[model samples]
Target: MLLVLAATGALRGVLDLRTPLVVTILANLLNIALNLLLVHGFDLGIGGSAAGTAIAQWAAALCLVAVVLRRARAAGSSGRPDVAGVVAAARQGVPLLARTATLRAALLLGTAVAATFGDAPLAAHQIATSLVSFLAFALDAVAIAGQTLTGRTLGAGDAEGTRALTRRMIVWGLGTGVVAAVLLLVLAPFVGGWFTPDATVHDALVPALVVVALVQPISGVVFVLDGVLIGAGDGVYLAWAGLAVLVAYAPLALLAGSLGAGLAWLWAAYGVFQLARLVTLWLRQRGDAWLVLGA
Candidate 1:
């Protein structure tokens, strides 16, 4: 998992994610083959599955490293790693790390709040949360495009291009969100049945899923703007924005926990959080504040 993460991050930095994406696909394919070969052919059970996964992960990492090196060579860049560059990279990444950590903390807190509601609500919440997470991949594809394009356009001093790209990407994000929302609503009946036999769990999941669907467009706008901010080198403000969101989200989350609010309310807490993010990001984008014109 760590290896894949590192490789993916490295690939994202250079806007060369195809290599890592392919690596992931191939690794998972290899994992399946190894699981069948080991677990079935060798008659090893769960241990074989674990070993297969470990082997696939390491192989994928190595493949990514080779691709990175080859790409560097082909690009004719001085292909050497240095401690100073590593330190500088880590220094630059601190704000992003803080942003990610705090966001994840909020998610975990939501889960804890759901757990207080009883087993059924907690189970339903997990399913709904998982649904949101899976849909996020689709939305993030637009954000990633925004990030790469924003960085390159800013680097080239094309402020107009940067603005246009941000606008277009935000539209794409919203469109993606709308699609996710429709899919979620359409799948509500069948999805709940696929997950569990408990009628209560299924019933609880349906409404929460609606809430999740309702928030998709909001989440979409927030995510794309987040990428634009990061790409424009507004990490400090982004970190501050994340902190402000934490403050806003905490009260609602706490209230939900204390009152044992339904799963929809907990997800609504997330909506508040995403709404705050949209405001923060829009403020930055409204002016030249995030427009670091050169380098």
Candidate 2:
């Protein structure tokens, strides 16, 4: 993962969009093939899946490094790894990493809490969360685009371009969310069946799935804003905002259980957290001169 991050950051600094996109797509395809081979053909299970992923990631990292070095050489640059540059990048990235880690940890905690409600509720929560994650991941592509464009615009000191790109990418992200929600709602029955043969699980899952579908568009916007802030090097805000949301998890879980709140309330907590982050980011961005539209 570290190597992949390094390769991506370095390549982003030097390469154009098309090259990296092609490489990323091809590498993901290779990784998927490796996953299938190890898991299905060899019956290596989850460990095999992990090993396949690691190998594919390292392979992609090496390829990206090679491409970057070649380009640097062609440009008559030294093609040497800049330790200072890496350090600077790490300084900016650490806070975002912390925020991401904290949020994921809270999610895991939420999962544990749901599991305490028994197999049916746990299964339902898992199905709903998985569906939500699929939508989030799809929208994240647009967020990444926003991040890349925002960074390049800042680097070029083109404030107008940054604002325009941000708005455009946000729209795209929300659009993806809407599409994911619609598709998931339409296919809920089929998807629920694929997860379990239990009619009870399916019954529990249906309502949660609908809730997830409703939340996707809002979550998508939040993710896009997150990407925008990260690209703007506003990781401190991201970290604090994430921490604040995380603080609500334990209390919320306790209250929900004690108050006999349903699975719907738990799912609603996710939407609340996301919405809070979105509002916080929007407020912060609005006040910051650096992030001001066309500033």
Candidate 3:
């Protein structure tokens, strides 16, 4: 993840879009190949899966390092790696990591709460979550774009530009969410069936899948807002915002009577959390006049 972030930062500073795009494609291809060989050819199972992923990551890191070194050589630079730049990036990243970890833990807690209902509910929740994961992949790309744009804008001392980008992202995000929701609603039953042959699990999962699908876009917006805030170096706010969301989970879960109810409440809470982040980020961006001051 650090290498990817470094590569992105470097690309933003020095390289063209095509270079990073090509590198990302190559890295993903290599990762897929490693996964295939380790999981299928060697039957290494989960351990092989881990090894494959680690190897692929190292390969990408090497590639990124080579790119950085080449850039340095082309510039006739003799100094060490950009320690200060890296440290600044790390400072911003640490809180984002904390926020992510806290959010993930809350998700786990939600799953555990669902499990308390019984095996059927647990299975349904897992299936719904898996579907949500698939939806998130596409949304994640948008979030990454928001992060990159936000960071670049802030770095350039263009607060107005950053605000514009954030608004555009949110608008597009809402539209994307509605479309994804509609598709999920239509496909929920079929998607649910693919997960299991069990009728009870399928029945319980279909509605949950629809709910997740409809709300996925909202979740995507939240994720994008998070990226924007983190890119702006608002780590403290990110941590506090994540903590607020985490705090909401238990009470909401306690109020839920059934697995579906719990999932619904969870999704609603997620949307509220994300909207709150958008509001907070907008306010912070507006209030911080220094952020717009010339470099």
Best by lDDT: 1
Tens digit of per-residue lDDT, candidate 3, span 22-78: 777887888888889999999999888888778877777777768877887888987
Backbone clash count, each prediction separately: 0, 0, 0
RMSD in order of candidates: 1.6, 3.2, 3.4
Higher-scoring candidate on lDDT, 2 or 3 = 2
Cα lDDT tens digits for candidate 2, 75-130: 89897778998798789879988999878887787787787778898988898878
Question: Which ten-residue region of model 2 has the weakest summed lDDT?
Answer: 286-295
Candidate 1 residue pairs in clash (backbone atoms < 3 Å)? none
1-295 in candidate 1: lDDT tens per residue? 7667766766787888788878889999999999999999999999999999999999998988777778778889678877898897787689988888878888899998999999999999999888888888779888887887888899989999999999999899999889988998899877988889999999889888988888999889888998888888788888888988898999999897898778888888888888888888888899898898874
**What stretches of model 3 exceed 4 Å from their correct place?**
1-5, 12-21, 31-55, 75-79, 257-262, 265-286, 289-294
The residue ranges of model 2 lying beyond 4 angstroms of the native Cα positions read 13-21, 24-55, 289-295
List the candidates' TM-scores in order. Answer: 0.94, 0.86, 0.81
Candidate models: Cα lDDT each = 0.87, 0.78, 0.71
Predicted structure with the largest TM-score when compared to the true one: 1
Error of 1 at 1 (Å): 4.5
